[model samples]
Target: MGEFLIDLKVNKNYIWVYFIAFYTLWCIRELWLNLYLDSIDSVPGAVTSAIIKIIIWVIPVILLVIIMEKRNPFSYLGLLYNVKNGLKWIGWASLVLLFYSILNITLLKNSIDFQLELREWLNVVLLVGITEEIVFRGFLLRKLMDSFRFWIANAITALLFVSIHFPIWFYKGQFEFPYIFSSILTVFVLGIIFGFIYKKSKSLWSVIIIHSLYNLLVSLFY
Candidate 1:
């Protein structure tokens, strides 16, 4: 009986290891999808870009769910499919973010630039805001919280979030210390705020809406 119990424990550990490995790899693949989708400048229509973005984003999430189902056949789908609750959070977060944006723009005297056309704006809303939120808040943060304490998970995930923006500085040729410092600091602060929301609500939709609205306000004001 003792030997049998030890074997069962080892098997359980192996299963968890497999789950973590699979989840990480899937996340990396999703990151690659985002990079590739962002590179497609020749795409003509807003609908086309939106469709391609959805495909890239949804495929991996579906794959992850299938893997989870295989691992835990009795897993409840309700935990993952909380769209209604998510929308409620999003509604409230939107109001708060709107106010935040107005204050930042008016009080801080941030300049507004409306260079992006409607199609471009739609692409930004779908690809950059929604899809990225699903990947970061829904996938990476959730997985990290499973393995680490809440605060530690939030810190590490936030750092990763900031590091991923390194290419922006490179492309702009503004890789100065001050620019890097400020960008990281701002993202870290935003990450902490978003992480707090995620922790409190446990709903990705809330943060997704908040992030989208925040970006929209920044674009409008700055």
Candidate 2:
């Protein structure tokens, strides 16, 4: 029992540590980008700003991980893996995403309005799609898998993925429970799919590409 308690404590500590580090990094990135945009006369759309910020922020984080953890940023790219298998995985994931896009369009017709502009489309592809996959799938998911079982890691990361979006409700100043719930459910499903792909292929780039394409399709079709 004592050993179990110790393990639980350790797990909790790691989760909190990872969350705090990521959140701090994100906050700093946002602040810097906002300030930079303010200094400039011609600014891009919110999506463009978000993508630019993520790119600017992720570089240093990747470098830090490489230096401190002695880990390769591209380790999850799976260049050493079988090419045919990788393509198969990507194809399967893309089909799943295509189906989800159709469902999203059918269910949330109005939600499409939130991402209409070209800049917004770009943002969804970069910030929401690629950057998010890197953080959740690439960093947090990988780190969690190191300590916990696969299912546990996926569940926890999926929950965190939903929780991160809670701020949207606060920003809107409306509860909108149904909408939020649906969004969370969608994110959880996507998380599971992406997590499964990551485990199967051990390639972050594979999941990242799938994620980016999925978001692009959703943005375009929906």
Candidate 3:
């Protein structure tokens, strides 16, 4: 099981350290938010939340590529470049995913409410979409592929991607059956899909845009 992970840490051993640290810190961020910062609304709260995520979710992965992998962060993470390919992949992905959304609403008889706040746009949509991809697909999935096959690595990475959301679900009291189970499964599937996109396009931005779009659709619909 363990041998299925990326071997970058086997000799230097810092990869798992960063992974563990980031996971623990993300859990703590949720705990602190629900425990204390829940009431900190408005711009201040959004700024604080974004800052927290930047520290915990964004920084560690950047450091991992820069320090551990000893490579350029942008190149390592497949960001800001490969624009054409990213667009091409996202174009195809959007068709399939948007079809699902259309089918969902058609069956459910729901319309797009099309509402989003500034904080959600900044913190939830952009920040989460960008950073989470950086951590999971750009960093983890690519690294994991060194040791394990794509599907195997992607499955494990997807489970991990699901795990990171548990604390927030737990804190928000959304960790019950049916909802939790379904949500976890959905997220795991998303992780797999995102990995596939990244693998095909070799562009993190492709996954990022699709991920942000998924979140945006969910927000607009429900």
**Rank by TM-score, descending?**
3, 2, 1
RMSD of 1: 5.6
Q: Regarding TM-score, does 2 or 3 come out ahead?
A: 3
Off by over 4 Å in 2: 1-15, 24-48, 55-57, 76-84, 99-116, 172-175
Q: What order do you get sorting by lDDT, best first?
A: 3, 2, 1
Select the stronger candidate by TM-score from 1 and 2: 2
Candidate 3 lDDT tens digits, 1-222? 576455534634565677898888888888888877555456788788888888887787887777667899989889967889999999997898789788878998777765677667777778888889989998888888877899999998899999998997898789998888899989999999999889888999999999998888777776
- For candidate 2, the per-residue lDDT at 32 reads 55
Q: Which runs of model 3 end up more than 4 angstroms from their true locations?
A: 1-12, 37-40
Candidate 2 to truth, TM? 0.70
State the local distance difference test value for candidate 3: 0.84
Q: Write the per-residue lDDT of candidate 2 for residues 66-139, one digit (tens) a residue.
A: 75456677664333455566678888877887677778778766245454665455555766656777777777
**Global lDDT scores for all candidate models:** 0.63, 0.67, 0.84
Q: 27-96 in candidate 1: lDDT tens per residue?
A: 5544554566455444454566567556655455445646643432112212345667767777887778
Which pairs clash in model 2? Answer: none
**For every model in order, what is the number of clashing pairs?**
0, 0, 0
Q: Using lDDT as the measure, which candidate wins?
A: 3
Judged by lDDT relative to the true structure, which candidate is superior, 1 or 3?
3
Q: Candidates' TM-scores?
A: 0.67, 0.70, 0.89
